[model samples]
Target: RSDRNNAIRSPTSIDMDHNDQDEVPTASLGTWIFLVVVAAVSFWSQATVTEERFVPALNVIANIFNIPDDIAGATLMAAGASSPELFSSFVALFITHSSLGLGT
Candidate 1:
């Protein structure tokens, strides 16, 4: 238990002087507007493509991989529903190069 605790306490996670908090940056109105527009476009494009193409493509991939029909249907359905989230995650990682992107 003690070793587990020690392992989790990285240099940044522990502070002897208690001065490790990050200051939030304030964005301008134009920046906020731009962020909103970008997010809206991302969501809209994801939805449009998902509805028109993602399911069919996923089916093709599953068939090519020789996945069982029963399991493939369920897996593809779940992936289809989560496509937006997966797309956003990739875009965030690319844009911010961070685990989590800038939150709105």
Candidate 2:
């Protein structure tokens, strides 16, 4: 059986809702805005927080780096999320510094 996805022509996605009956452009515009905002936030999280769980973080950062002047103003959003992880990793690293802690 052929894959359903194979039928589609365009490989990349750009959200464009087309229905001929109603030509209200507002909804489509709103969709674009939402996508853009999400991409921006994705960019910031990935870019700034150089922590280990940096997959999503990197994606968000890439959006910012690759895109135009388009990062959402809240740059610290990802850093805020990363604080707990960062703290824990720091503590782990500290503990690992001493072999004394390794033995019960």
Candidate 3:
């Protein structure tokens, strides 16, 4: 048990964000609500930026490259949409030391 804990706490691992004391941390209801709100806003902002900026920029690139709209959407757009999954898989395998299986 101690060895497993030590492995989890190794320097290369992501910070667990806990105190040295062996006690569970607690959060108030207000704090939980605030965190939820912040998460929602963050997701909203990310989506807005991607839709407003990223996709249009890709479209411009496709035009500059003289790519057909269908081909561009099928290739570049599909790649753009799948990038988050690829990046998350990379993080899971490398940073989190987890396997990315079919479900992951």
Best-matching candidate per TM-score: 3
Give the per-residue lDDT of model 2 (tens digit) for 1-104.
35665567354432344455686556688899999999999998866664555446555765767733234224445666667877666666576664343332
| Poorest lDDT segment (10 consecutive residues) of candidate 2 | 67-76
Candidates 1 and 3 compared: the better one by TM-score is 3
**Would you estimate the TM-scores of all the predictions?**
0.38, 0.24, 0.48
lDDT of 3 by residue, 1-104 (tens): 98888776867453456555767688999999999999999999999998999889888989899998889878997888888998898888888878773366
Arranged by TM-score with the best first, the candidates are 3, 1, 2
After superposition, candidate 1 runs with Cα above 4 Å error: 1-24, 58-73, 79-104
Error of 3 at 29 (Å): 0.7
C-alpha positional error of residue 23 in candidate 2 after TM-score superposition, expressed in Å: 13
Which residue runs of candidate 2 sit more than 4 Å off their true CA positions? 1-27, 51-104
**What's the CA error at residue 49 for candidate 3, in Å?**
0.7
Error of 1 at 22 (Å): 12
Worst 10 residues of 3 by lDDT: 12-21
> Model 1 compared with the native: what TM-score?
0.38
